[model samples]
Target: MVRSILIFVITYALFLISGFLFQIDQSWYDALNKPAWTPAGGTIGMIWSILFACIAASITIIDRKAGGLNNLKPAFWIILIVNYLSNQLFSFFQFSQKNLGLATIDCAIVAISAIILTVFALNIRKIAGILLVPYVLWTSFATFLSFMFYSMNL
Candidate 1:
């Protein structure tokens, strides 16, 4: 139980670090020609918060279902870490570097890695996989948004 809580906190914190480390340039982002369907800032934040929480929960569940963190397969760890790194890179590419094209590609990686992670989680536990659905969906949506941002700005 204690381990699960620790895992949840650690995972969520790691995911949240991108926001802190690569602060978004509001002026630049706001000036972009966004689609009418683009989510407002508050809505985007809320969605991310919820998605992060779900991702943390999914990881925790997978860890438990596999018997323990150490028992998790190396392949799972590789995919999970890759997904996390790709996720963090989005903030750097989109905000810090202001490279929408790179951000769009990174988002696609995040979405694809997330789908792979979900499949791995499903092999361990159904609920764990289910928990990641929103993360997968949101990342896929964000990928589209990133592409739109790139094309519109170009």
Candidate 2:
């Protein structure tokens, strides 16, 4: 139980670090012609926070089932890292660089990675896998949102 808590903390910390490193350019983002369905900035942050909490909880469950982080398959780590990086890249491309095309591509990768993570987790632990459903759904929606941004702005 202690180990699971530790893993959750570490996982969440990494998420925070990624967010800090990929700080959004609010001024540039505000200039974009966003879709009507786009959530407010605060709502976006709240959604991400909820999603990250879900991810951290799911990771803890997986860590417990796998006997430890070290015991998990290499593929799990690879997918997790790829998903995190792809997610960060979406923010970087969309807000920092203001490149909707590249951002859309990054978001697509993120959605794909989320699906991969869910399938891989299911193979490891049923409940752990189930926990990723929300992540997958959210990423799918985000991918659509990114596509809309790209299409509307271009």
Candidate 3:
């Protein structure tokens, strides 16, 4: 019980770190020309937080189902870590250098991670599958936004 809670908390913290890394909300991002439909920062944050919660729950459920970390879903775990690191890299690198090209790819990976997690969640746990829905949808939106950002900035 405690472990599960810890896992969720740690995972959420990792996501929070990714969000703030390299000062992603800095002036440069604000200065960039964005689509008229781009969401405000508060909305983006709220959406991301909800998505991250889903992801954390999914991870907890899936990991628990996989023989309590013994026969553990190695692939699922790896992909999740990759997804988190990619997200952090995107936020940090894209903001620091304003690298939209990489951000585009990074955002795609985020969506891909959500998809992978969703599929694995279906096999491992239903709660897990449901948990990733928000991430998949939201990250898909983020991917589209990233492409627009790249197109406009370039």
Candidate 4:
């Protein structure tokens, strides 16, 4: 159980660290002709960092209760992977070369992945379900932001 949680924490830490490696300057982002309502990069980063932490903690609790890796459900693994990957990919789409279209699609994917992960997490642990609440909410908000960005930019 503790082992399972450990894995989630470690993976999440790496995910975060990887993000920090890419330096997206605020000035650069601002210089780009963004839509009127796009959030400041720091604000978005902080929110995502917090949400990712919560998700890490939530899955850890579930992992502990589930009696370690073998007992952990496949859906749990898949959704987590998808969520993490989508999160990582969005940075690429949003920051690298500034592709609003790809960013919108990736953000939507993250939102859907959150929904699926939340559902699967619920089946494994109620706390896990509750844990995903912030993630789900933010992702939904991001979807709107992305959609708006796409519409405005395109």
- lDDT value, candidate 3, whole model: 0.82
Best by TM-score: 1
* lDDT (tens digit, per residue) of candidate 2 on 1-154: 7888888888877776656767777787787778888999899888888888888988998888878879987888999999988987877787677788998999999999999999998998888888889889988998899888888788
Model 4 is weakest, by summed lDDT over 10 consecutive residues, at: 17-26
lDDT (10s digit) by residue, model 1, range 80-138: 99999999999999999999999999999999999999999988999999999999999
The local distance difference test score of model 1 is: 0.94
Order by TM-score, highest first:
1, 2, 3, 4
Over 4 Å off, model 1: none
Please list all clashing residue pairs in model 4, or write none if there are none: none
Off by over 4 Å in 2: none
Ranking by lDDT: 1, 2, 3, 4
lDDT of each structure?
0.94, 0.85, 0.82, 0.79
Show the lowest summed lDDT stretch of 10 residues, model 2. Answer: 13-22
Over 4-121, each residue of candidate 3 has an lDDT whose tens digit, in order, gives: 9987898788888855557765577889889999999899889888877887887777668875655665797798777888877778657876789998898899889878868878
Q: Which regions of candidate 4 are displaced past 4 Å?
A: 1-5, 33-37
* lDDT, model 4, position 101: 87
Alpha carbon deviation, residue 66, candidate 3 (Å)? 2.1
